[model samples]
Target: MDWKSFMEGSKDLSVFALALRAVILYIALIIATRMMGHRQVGILSGHNYLVAAGIVSLAAIRMLNPESSLTSGIVIVFVYAFVNVLLSYLDIKWPKAIDRKPTILMKGGMFLRENMLDCHVTLDNLLGQLRLKGAPNLSEIDSIVLEPYGKISVIKKPEALPLTRKQMNLPPKMVALPTILIYDGKIDEMNLHQMGLDHEWLITRLREKGIMNLKDVFLAMLEANGTVYVSV
Candidate 1:
């Protein structure tokens, strides 16, 4: 129960020791994350995920087993991290060395059965995935490639593409980016100042919109084109 008992590698780890171990593991993981330079959770490849899972498992062992050395666990983490960094560098130099290229799952409205089978992806699952990727109609899709990171890339047929403004011979219009001027009935003075406007102008706009009490207005937005949208 005491610090001395915990430090002596006592068989029963006290709650304090466990908490301290947890903090150490947290910091270790943070350092590992920084070393890996991978910020996005979903962007890691399957192999990277396995490495991450292994590091977590080691951290778990340190937390669960009083006999397990925290120093050893942390060293293992850095070892994994170093190997990962080395492999990543090699991967950049030689792309196919670590991860395979994207697999063509479908082409010209026909499924690549061999690739799908190799990936262990069922036909129904592929169909559902395609739908989720915004290709609901298989007939409209020109191709579908399974990316190395496990995402499906959908390519629609040129004929199935939506009509564009240029195609219609229409003049290009400037798209307005709306800024929040009022949120939850509170004036965003910072945003107002940023937009080169003042409180009096906002009140005048509110008066024009018949919004007497700022508290009654739920949300208000100002667009780059000087358009104001108010929601009460």
Candidate 2:
């Protein structure tokens, strides 16, 4: 269709009218996210992102089908609301694991170049972030961390020696694994059955926290410390 035709509005919305709808939807999203009381900054999951993609996609479809109802728009809003809830709940329950906490990127000025490469951070970026935290010299900084929240932190060194894993003959590398006890607000039955894990054990644990059903939880994971954390 021509641009002019699209720009025109009838009782059925044209492109210009749809553009107005888009604007209003965006405003509403901002309000919804703010009300949800989670950090609006940092890397968000694709499912959790609160953009107008669904509305934008449905815009043309609605334009073509004048009889289209507001049901699709409402469904999109619900989708975002659900995702936003899941993210917020997960972050709150596992603040250390889910949210960005500073991981030691550099210690004792020895240069943990390997870790920097793994986390996809650069030396220059690390230096800039450290400078913001008043780290004037590499010698003065005890540790530099690339936080998961896309921020860097610098800690000034005290009069202490650095610990070397090689010097101590520890493992060369660490691999952190996430426990998959819960998915989509439901307990993974197959995982529990194969692992010989007990649902009753989990239920008792949750009861101590006043949580009742597995379905009420959005995410759950077991830490290396042998604790099961659940989020709703």
Candidate 3:
């Protein structure tokens, strides 16, 4: 099967040289990303995603083509990053030019079909997002906004909203964020200490639930109400 030829490319550069190039390119990408500021990876806008994809494609080409000059690839990567930074600044100054406005797909339980079509969203797609958001029927939603980043934002109708404590004149209760004691059968000691708990206390709670070993538990969460939820 010519395994040796497949493992080592016909290129003149050694494996170590390729490895060194990859390390340098990785560091360059990290520095470029840091200069771009803190933007959530999951919520990158269309322009940001395109710029990132371009940088990746350039890096991949340089990695695959050993004859290609690394300096050229690095320069191109920096140029793309600089362009992204400039566009980001323009987006903040003139949002309308750099960013598309959110489209209102539905208003007052009525589908704005024109807006939906303009946003390239179909009825089935909108309905699927609505179902995911727990709004099965149009009557339950006051509006549906298609965000610029390609996410659906749903607003439930006032009449369909769940009752709050203010509606029933109930006293407000302090709610604390849940702390993860164990995840994937591994204990988070820092989280345990933050909650003023220790391994011995955790074992006692586990024993109360008839669980003797931590390895058997897949997840353990302590909620704001002092409720310990364990899953095996």
Candidate 4:
């Protein structure tokens, strides 16, 4: 047995060259993952998962095939990820055309058998999902919606609903939603503009909080209650 051939393993590629290929392909995969965005890290829908699998497979080719070009492998993976990004954008722009809509399996205490059959959901599937969601008795359920992402959303009947401030005759307090004005010391000009604010106004507000330099702020948040929270 040739010592060098045995040392290089099956591909006949040198250990250093193989390691280099692995590192380059790994970096390409990271770039493709980022191009696909953070949503890919979460519970992926069918198409999203397919794209992610395809990317990994493409990257693997570069590692296994000694003759394959690293640049070509990177390009193929990037193109696949870009297609997913494009489809996601189109899905947002034309949801009905690009993606499936949520289907109502149960409504008004009645199970829609036809709808369930069309979605290929069996009685056990519905019951299991309801159990997982901690739903009350089937009779107390007002609606069971199958979301496009394959998750079930349950709505309970008004009688079975939990008590809230409105039911107790208590006045509702204002809720302030926080919006980021600056992230990582960079001002979100679009958000600032949407809030009807300008650079001068933001600078003045920051000054009031004893923050003289924008770069010193790691985050700046604006609440609906007219409060500005800054973090250094």
Candidate 5:
């Protein structure tokens, strides 16, 4: 076997070269994304999706074709990002012209067949979405609107909705998001600091659960109720 050649990679494109290209492309993508802003990664509009698709295609071309220069890929990625930003601005200014309006699929338990057909949504597809959204029967739903981004928004009928704690005169309780203390044997010191904790507290908690070494922990989370959940 040609083990030396296998380890070194092909003459045209070495493994090291590929790795370097990947890292550079990854960093370039991150910079491009940041320039485009957070909206690019959110529920994508039509133009946003197009820009994302173009970026992916350009990156793939650069990775597959070693003859293609990384500088060219980076330039194209930025170009696409800027174009998306421009389109997003235009969408905000002239929404009716640049963006499609949400279509009402159903209202008052009645399906709008014309709107459904216009949106290219089949009856089965609508039913499946409704089922997924926890509305088994049409009577349970007040309305269903199809967003521009192909997501279905269901509004349950007020009379058909379940009773909430507010309806029963129950007081609300403060809820905090769970913080990860450790993951995959690595301590998240930043998260600990954010939660106003330190290493000493985590060590004491672990030792109480008979876990001496941090490396032995698979996962450790600090719950909202001041509870430490540890998994080995």
Candidate 6:
């Protein structure tokens, strides 16, 4: 039998069963996506979006597979992981092949029609994005970049703006990497390593505060300037 017949022949659920499957699939997708990290959802970069699409696509396939049982769903998660690894390897080996670099529609106040056409962007759509940024008149814009994810980012001319940074009084710059020390009562060892501290350091500090277990700490961070903050 063909794939369709095969699917129908196997896991052929009643209408109620299909409804139950749909509900379960929805919840599973949400949890799976959350575990996958922030890059899995929201506005994704080209590289990330491709992977996200593949993951969701496979998950959908398995969810809809008539042959797919509860076990099949579990297997599909593995399939998603395998596909990610394989694609990642291919992307690293020949970065150019799978990566479609976005074209610049506008730069230095000059419009590049050829590039815009290649990106499948038109003037009206370009102006809409610009107008959203309160630049109804495109002449007030300095540059517009058509990012790979089909986002139109516009930077208005510096002179066009009325406020100066000095007047705003922004800070010098403080960079902090907020690491999750405990997620669902578990310590993130990789993040701790990236922060140049051993598990001993984390435990030592927390112990000083009368917290003996990593599970007691909800979040932690090491600022670029060498300061550790913990949250329970």
Candidate 5 per-residue lDDT, tens place, 1-232, comes to 3333332334476667776777888899999999989888986989989999999988887776666777767888888988988999999999889988899999988889999889999999988988888888887888999998878999988999888888989987559998999999999989999988999999999999999989999999999889999999
- Backbone clash total for model 4 is 0
Q: Model 2 over residues 168-198: C-alpha lDDT tens digits?
A: 9997755456577787778887766755678
RMSD (Cα, Å) of candidate 4?
Answer: 7.4
Ranking by TM-score: 1, 5, 3, 4, 6, 2
User: Which one is best on lDDT?
Assistant: 5
- Models 1 onward score TM values of 0.78, 0.47, 0.74, 0.64, 0.75, 0.53
Clash-forming residue pairs, model 4: none
lDDT of 5: 0.86
Which of the two, 2 or 6, has more TM-score? 6
Cα RMSDs of all predictions? 3.5, 14.6, 5.5, 7.4, 6.1, 8.7
User: How close to the true structure is residue 50 of candidate 6, measured as C-alpha lDDT?
Assistant: 62
Q: Per-residue alpha-carbon lDDT of model 1 for 65-84, expressed as tens digits? A: 87777777788889988888
lDDT of 4: 0.84
Candidate 1: which stretches are off by over 4 Å?
1-9, 173-194, 204-232
- Cα displacement (angstroms), candidate 4, residue 88, comes to 1.0
Give lDDT: candidate 2, residue 221.
73
lDDT values for all models: 0.83, 0.64, 0.83, 0.84, 0.86, 0.67
Candidate 6 displacement at residue 197 in angstroms: 34
Residue 45, model 2: lDDT of 36
What TM-score should be assigned to candidate 3? 0.74
Model 5 residue runs over 4 Å out of place are 1-19, 179-220, 225-227
Error of 6 at 43 (Å): 3.6
Model 6 weakest lDDT span, ten residues long = 1-10
Worst 10 residues of 2 by lDDT: 1-10
Error (Å) of candidate 2 at residue 63 is 12
